[model samples]
Target: MYEHLEYYGVSKKVIEAMNKIDRKLFVPPEYQDSAYVDTPLPIGYGQTISAPHMVGLMCEYLELREGNKVLEVGTGSGYNAAVMSLLVGPTGKIYTVEVVKPLYDRAKKIIQQLGLENVEVFLSDGKFGLEEFAPYDKITVTCYAKEIPPALIEQLSDGGILLIPVGDEYVQILKRIRKHGTKIAEESLGHVRFVPMV
Candidate 1:
C-alpha cells in the first residue's frame, strides 16, 4: 500500500504516517480483504472510509507538522483521523467530530484500542466546527458540503489551512482554503465525490 501510494506521488511523510496505521483495522470484517486496494469502503451509516490516495493527498496538502493541532470534520471510520494523528505526532492533537452516534462510538472505540492518545472523537454535527477547540492550525472536512461552512473559517487560526469539498451531493470540488489575518484565499484541488455533509 505504501508503494502504491508512493507511485501516485504521495509524499514520503504522509506515506510513513499511513504505514503506522493499519487500514484493515479501520474497516469492517467483510471489507478486510479489500482494505489495501486504495478504494473507499463502506463503514455503515451510509458513510465510507476515504480511499487511501485521497487521504494521502489531503495530508500532503495540509502540510501537517508535529505539534500542530488539527480539526477533522467527519470522523467516518476514523481512518483519516488516525493517519493525521501520526503526522501531528504525540505533541499534536486531532479533534474529530461525527454526527452519527454509531460511527462516533465505533471510531472512538477503535481510536482508544489503538492507544492514540492525541486523538479525541466527539459526537456532534461537524458543520458547527467544534468551537470549544477553535483556532485549529489545520482543518479537514471529509464529507462534502454545499458551501464552506462559516463556522469552520471562523475557527481557523490565522495562517491556517482548510481542505473541504463543496458542491452538490453527486460531486464536489475539493478546495484548499487558507486564512491569512482577515483575508481568505481559496484554490481548487479538483473534483471529488464524497458523502454529503448533513
Candidate 2:
C-alpha cells in the first residue's frame, strides 16, 4: 500500500500511518484479497473505500499532528478514520460520521475491534457537521458535493485544513481549504469522481 502511494507525493507521516493501518480489516470479506491493491473497493450502500493513493493525498493535505482533533465526514468502511487515528496517535481524537446506519454500525464495530480508542464513529447527517465537537483541527469529506457545506467550514478551527470534493453530481474537484481567522484559502488538488454527499 505504501509503495502504491509513492507516486502521489504523500508525506512521510501519512505513509507511515497507511503502512501501520490494516486495509484488510476495513474491506468486505469477499474483497479481502484485493485489500492491499491500492484501489477503491465497494463497501455496499453505493459507497466505496477510497483508493489508497487518494487517502494518502488527503492525509498529506491535512498535515495532521499528534495532538490535533480531526473530523471525518462519510466514514464508509472506516478505513480512512483508522489511518487518521494512526496518524494522530493516542493523544489525538477522530470523530467520523456516516449518514448510512448500516455503514455506521459496521464501521463503529470495526474501529472498536481494532482498539482505536481515540476514534469515534456516529450515525448522522454528515452535511450538518458535529457541532458538539466544533473547531476541529482537520476535516476530511470522503463524498462529493455541489458546494462546500457551510457547517463544515464553521466547524473547522482557525488555521485548520479541510479536504473535500466539490462540483456537480458526476464530476468534482478535490479541494484543500485552509482557514485563517474568518478567511479561507482554496486550492484545487485535482479532478475526481466520488459518490455525492448525502
Candidate 3:
C-alpha cells in the first residue's frame, strides 16, 4: 500500500504516517479485504471513508509539521484522522468533527482504542468548523461542499492552509486555500467525487 501511494507522489512523510495506521481497522468487517485498495468504502450512514490517495494528497498538500494543529471537518471512519494523528505527532493536536452520531461515536472509540492521544473527535455539524478550537494551523474537509464554508475560513490561522472539495454532489474540484494575514489564495488540486457535506 505504501508503494502504491508513493508511486502516486505521496510524500515520504505522509506515506510513513499511512503505514502506521491499519486501514483494515477503519473498514467495516465485510470490506476488510479491500481496505488498502485506495478506494472509498461505505462506512454506513451514507458516508464513505476517503480513498487512500486522496488522504495522502491532502496531508501532503497541507504540509503538516510535527507540532501543527489540524482541524478535520469530516470524521467519516476515522481513517484519515488516524493518518493525520501520526503526521502531527505527539506534540500536535487534531480536532475532527462529524455530523452523524454513529460515525462520530465509532470514530471516537476507534481512535481511543488505537491510543492516538492527540486526536479528539467531536459530534457536530462540520460546516460550523468547531469554533472553540479556532485558529487551526491546517484544516481539511473530507466531504464536498457547495462552497467553501465561511466559518472554516474564519477559523484558519494566519499563514494556514485548508484543503477541501467544492462543487455539486456528483463531482467537485479539490481546492487548496492558503491564508496569509488578510489575503487568501486558492488553487485547484484536480477533480474528485465525494459524498455531500450535508
TM-score of every prediction relative to native: 0.98, 0.96, 0.97
Question: Residue 63 of model 2: what lDDT?
Answer: 92
Tens digits of lDDT, candidate 3, 38-87 = 78999998999888998898888899999999999999999999999998
The whole-model lDDT of each prediction reads 0.94, 0.92, 0.93
Write model 2 residue lDDT over 50-128, tens digit each, in one string: 9998899888888988988999999999999999998898999999999999999999999999899999998999999
Worst 10 residues of 2 by lDDT: 1-10
Residue 48 lDDT in model 3?
95
Give lDDT tens digits, candidate 1, residues 70-163: 9999999999999999999999999999999999999999999999999999999999999999899999999999989999999999999999
Models sorted by TM-score, best on top: 1, 3, 2
Q: After superposition, how far is residue 111 of candidate 1 from its true place, in Å?
A: 0.4
- Note the residue pairs that clash in candidate 2: none
Shift of residue 170 alpha carbon in model 2, Å: 2.7
- The weakest ten consecutive residues by lDDT in model 3 span 1-10
